[model samples]
Target: MTFEREFFYDEVRDGFYIPGIIKRFWAYELTILSEIDRICKKYNIPYYADGGTLLGAVRDGQFIAWDDDIDIMMLRKDYNRFAQIAQKELPEELSFNSLEVNQDCEELAASVGKQVVGFAAELLRKYHEYPYAGSVDIFIVDELEKDPEVEEHRSLLLRRILFLIEAIEKHGKSKAVLKEINEIEKIMKIQFDQRTALKPQLRRVMDKIFQEFNGREGDQLAIMQFYAFLGNCKYPRSALDKSKWTPFCGMQLPIPEDYDAVLRAEYGDYHKKVKGGGGHGYPCLKKYENKLKTLMKGTWDPDYHFSEEDLVRPKIQNFRDIAISMAEAFKLSHKQLFEDCLKGDISTCISRLSRMQEEAIAFGTAIEQKKGEGTESVRVLEEYCDALYQAYNALSDLTALKEDGIEKQKQTEEICRSTDISSGLQKELEKIANTLLYYPEKLQTALKKDFKRQVVFLPHSMKYFESIRPIVDAVLKAEDMECKIIPIPYFDKYGDGSPKEMHYEGDAFPKEYKITDYRTYDFASELPDCIVINSSYDEFNQVWSVAPSFYSKEMKKYTNKLIYIPWFVTDEINPHAKEDEKAFINMEYYVTVPGLFHSDLTIVQSEEMKKAYLAKIEEFAGKDVAKKMEKKIAGAGSCLLGEKEGEGIQNVVDCFRLFLEK
Candidate 1:
């Protein structure tokens, strides 16, 4: 089957744009997904979209805008059965890669199906004009013992074995690496001949560890070897025991029966549209694009020998390259450390910081060891090292305070236990310690000083602009807040892949409001503190749609908060009244659209309207999500009605001020 999708350049994450090449890469991945779906149907092997792919399916009804790969999981038993028959069932264009199928493969997880051969090659050439191979990552969900301690031990052993496998592949079975592997194997109680390939040997040990708890009765299951250290990766066995079909792209794909619980467990606030780059860097096909093209042309050699430098780089590189690498590593590590801290994973944060310290020291020593470097270069390197150390010291202090906070929380719990307070009162005290003391203090410590937060307004049309004008005016007058009104372009989408015509509604906006040109304003770099949007239909609107780049989900990544202000206000409709209930039910199409679903906060016209919106959301998203949306959906009173009545405008202003302060 031919898989062709329209490709477009858009901002996929904050400061990260998806080039046309990445879109083509996504098309390649979609082809692989389709093939997998076909084989699974034919064989009756079960699979559910895993990780980011599942998040995308549930949230966007397709691939995550920034994601570069598709991930699916099968139970260990089903996975083994699929692995046995996938190659035979798959079309000529696709080839499944696993240790059993390709022993040289170094991946800990098996099954990178669809390597862009035969039909897939011709399809890409015909549609995308670029023949690039893409694969669906197949993860195995293995059963875990109910005991937390035993599960933890298994996870640790699996991680160590996986690490050694990676080290062997990268360092070529060096004595140091092999020594580490030997120790891990002894602990795993698996031994192998010295002449056997180190990579496959370690993988076998991992497989043994993974299968140890399989077939035994257990209530927990985990996606093996992928983020195994994360406490939330394990799930209740019931979460995946049954499956239901959900619309993904254009196909119905199996999802966990308890998808909501699974998503919530994996991502604390799964509904919130927070855009960030995936583990693999942006434009994931860059390294393989040329190689695939050459392979398609029959010039690529399958078994090319590597030069000495290719096998392993020198211990010390040129000063410039070393400095750049160190800086990049520090940035990535620092970002990850803060993310772990925010997730309340203090141990992971500390462990990452310790690794960063070691890396910093190594870099500093390498700089010192470099010979014939100019005095100026030496001075700069020394200065850089000093700054790095100072930053590390500050982070160390912050982590210590976080640890102290945890101690204080534990002490508070103990005090409550010792007292005559009711259980409810004890719970209240614990909550106070966590919300009022711990999180706020940690955030305060990390807050940067003397920076003006950017608040951007993206109003697609003149009518929508009027809906949010009051809030925009309030933000402009607020001190220490920078406001930019960037009116975006929309389109009249035909049912086909292309739009009928592009519309620039910004031209109709009042001339008094400062409008930044959509072409010039950089959403990624500005990284607005808050992004206010009036339109949210995205591609769902057949008549009039905002450009894909301006979708609320896309904007959510560039800003800390994506605030949605409804373009129209309705009179209060009491759900209790039959006529009003019917009216409210009919309004579901407007109330439960993507814009509101993806927004961080949505301000409705009045308290009555907020209830109406919540009722519709509950009907579709379930009661639990509706409960969470209570905080997200606010009643600010209509800006349009407020202006006409000339009284409730202050309420709108007050609401905007409260959100901005947070």
Candidate 2:
């Protein structure tokens, strides 16, 4: 099978065509195999090309250019040896992941994994992880008994595995394993001791199978993961123990000495070509992982770039000019805001960010009306500038959410993902994936957009939403922001899974936003940038339920986070609030700790009020819970402002401006 041309790998690009994703996947594949080959040669430990990779070598001489996966195997002893040293042996780019090496995932699988046979561990790129890029599968082979009884047992296991695969195909990988337990319970008619969905009771069963097959002295051997698929994957030990070199993608690599025998047994027609035998790679969407990375790193050029002219453009002839001024404002405020975030000065950060959003909204309106929707450059610039402001707010709010002195690096890890163990690079990749999933096409214009900072102002009702609009607008005035203020219905957030809903007439809602009525269902399609829960007087008075006690698990779907804002001021304990006929009895007069606890950041009346809330938290939740809650409680205005009535409103407005100026 010689050709006129030699498909030799190049020094710089290997055999890959530059800028092609599939080529890149192949390049990484060869890099891993070459590294593995070096280690095996250097250590004098043997491994042979197994499965499709070997088939590719004997059949194609080069990689089946379409094939994206690489497979190799070692005998149990060699496999153990590689496992012991593969981390140090392989390039740092390659990371080892197997049930034995990654006990965390192994145990996770054992407890929650579906009824599966032993899993084949893999070596993957460190940052890429699974299903995102090319990875190597290392099959570990053990001697198998070629007996009728053993064959029947293997067949039964195969049926269960078939069921497992179907379950995953129907449901998903995450839920497939859990449902396996249920299927087993129904079919087997036996209740296993392990009860929790997250528990791994199959470890013992798998271990018994491993021990049973491993102890048997037989002529046949098989990779444990594929025992059901490949019955008695037996060959003379010399075929692998003794190896031969063959040309694979222009490199001479070891395949089993009796490669034909192995291939014939595995593929039947080893010399034939199949049209369906195309190489598959991970879901290509993650290739755009860098799209978000670039965006977050502030690499993407927004439609409007900020310049000094923005500040000088007095009359603001165009939206791009407006963007320039806004960008400059952000540039000045960003440093101060970042420093404040590090100090957990979230009160100041939130205030400034809120103001920035308001200014952006005003500018956006000018552009929308003057230039109209065709002013995409203006709109995009507005959105991106808003995102930059929101990103800062998110990070600052994140600091407040964390324990004091936690490094910003650690803070990013927490902010980027829910689980603490998630890697930094992994988090960024996930952030991109999440952003793509969370926002609809209309809202995804700016990759720099920080959904975390985009806030949903969920007013208790139309009346409450209307009442706060004045204050919200006052803060937003002159600030470059595009945050939307959407109103929600008033009801017991904590009630039967579906809470009862009520409505009132004659309340004009905020402009440019649809009122999310509590009708047939909650809004399902759109996710909020941020959910700010306003604990207004109308809210407490309208319902007998207190703010602290009124929480709906459903609201988490809208946004997993919420920021609580104290709109009502009270000096007494257990202030009974009444709206119209409905009265909320036994509501805490001094503070709304229950509602505040839900907020990543709680905006209170003043520093003195923060202290009062801390005291209340300590009294009600004890010292441990209070310590966690103290940082979140920050006051933006004085409690005495409420006593002065109209003076209070002015003071609140002044306070917002003061924060923005700083």
Candidate 3:
């Protein structure tokens, strides 16, 4: 069957187009991301994120929720390498098209290289009507030459070549994909010959060579070996400083050294005048807006031009003819014929729509003629207006289908909703569980068994404790693990019961709440194989000193088996009545804030965080603790903690694959 003509309708508006454009855009972006990732992995090309992609990762740890585009850059060399491999390495449905290599230049130039974009095929097919949708830009950067004259020429040449290649590739691929395949092999041969002839005009030849060998069984394998050769050309991380990039709301993009001058030359005072449509629901380019105004004023009419009168005056004449024809064609249903005529043809529809205008004009003419006092013809015209009204509505619907953004949004939401869960809260919880549950099934199994591995969970509140009971019970049932949550007292009230007691009933009863004997409930003596602690002042102080010391005396009881889990009062749990669960106290290792507490080892998000944690340990517990922590943390890297050792603890928290905000 052909592609479905289903339209995404807005339930609220009783029409199609606008509600979830952002969501559709994001989904498309993610698909692109996966395609990029797959291509990069196959080629073994290390390309650092550029433009919006990198900014989103470094600043927000994710993509901007509303962004519809994905821009990534690779070094000129890697880009060339990727181009060489794109044909064979990329999927048939998803291949890269570049300016330098592709055969079609004229078409590419016309569409501004959109047709040659790696992600264009899917985008064009998916959102054929979306005006703002364009191809993914693969910017290639080269090392700046030291000699001024040579540098300038090289830069200019590079830019010129890039533009030319982009145009060529765009047109080439468009032709290749959309071409009639009367003889596939013959066409392929002709295409290759044309490409070879155009090779010298393009910048990179090796890329084209790679494209030649791209075959069904051998593409990625060939690309991988090719990439391995160029791996050494990668630049050091210090070459790009993220802070130097240009800011865009919450994101930033790497700018040329003379960014301000470049921007001014390209589009002066870009910041002074908004470059995009922010207030409008759909993204209307500033250029489009100017064109629209001009189009409306008729000073510079577009190719497919139509003025109000030009459109209506002719339609009125056509409608009058159609009305007379309908009266003769089907005498029994003159009204129905007139009604159907409006929805049938725009030219005729317009005429039928202008009847009222014609009547008004006639009345004015008659009034000028001094016959306005008696208007039987106008009265008769007024009675026949009902058919015209229906025609007008039908035409309006057709016009609206073209302009409404909500239609695409509705379609996208419908597609996504049918395929995946859309509840924001449910998605969040799943993200959290997926992120937090290390070794997922294993963790679930561990929770299910009766291993009764004593877990020291830092006190959040009674409700939190109740919520975690399932997580803990699941782990125990899976692996016979038993967890004991460490109760911490509120800092404001010293006379209150121990934090642990708050989880139990009867907190209001003085006897039930009081910590009668601290020695009897010695956490150190009762320390199980594993300890889960929260990152709290009292817990940090105790785990860093009191618990470790008192617990050390009984360390021989269970030598090395502590697992620290940093948790928070997840949205799934009771959040209003209690604070979040921050630390997990195990018998051996305690996971707390990377910089705040000294546990056996720590879990961090990035290599940066891992370094930060090590540095913090060195500061708090001396170089020995830092070194030891580093070794221990390094040893446990296989666990799915989702971070390096020294990165920011909060980064890890944020990355926890959980729903962070509502």
Which candidate comes out best when scored by lDDT? 1
Per-residue alpha-carbon lDDT of candidate 2 for residues 1-662, written as tens digits (9 for 90 to 100): 12111122111122211212333344446666777778778887788888778887887765653344677888776766776777776654456765566533322111100111111123222121121334567766776667868766865864574566455557654665666866766664656564332223343344335445665666666665455554544565445657888887657878888887677666678677532322122323233434433544754311122222211211112233334455556455555655554444444656766665676577567656644665554556465455656555454545454445567646754554454436554443334223322222333333223121333455655534533554566535533433555444444321111233343322466455544443332334444434566652222221122222224223434554455665454332221222200011112222432355545566666665566566656655567666877766556653224435334555554544443233
Model 1: how far residue 110 lies from native, Å: 2.7
Off by over 4 Å in 3: 1-19, 61-67, 106-134, 156-237, 240-662
Mark the regions of model 2 whose C-alpha exceeds 4 Å error after superposition: 1-19, 104-132, 161-211, 230-238, 277-662
User: What is the lDDT, from 0 to 100, of the residue 475 in candidate 3?
Assistant: 41
State each model's C-alpha RMSD to the native: 30.3, 31.6, 37.9
lDDT (C-alpha, whole model) for all candidates: 0.65, 0.48, 0.35
- In the range 58-81, model 3's lDDT, one tens digit per residue, is 445444432335656564456767
For model 1, the run of ten residues with the poorest summed lDDT: 304-313
Q: RMSD, model 3, all Cα superposed?
A: 37.9
Write the candidate numbers in order of decreasing lDDT.
1, 2, 3
The parts of candidate 1 lying over 4 Å away from their true place are 1-16, 116-121, 125-130, 166-172, 277-279, 292-662
Decoy 3 TM-score against native: 0.25
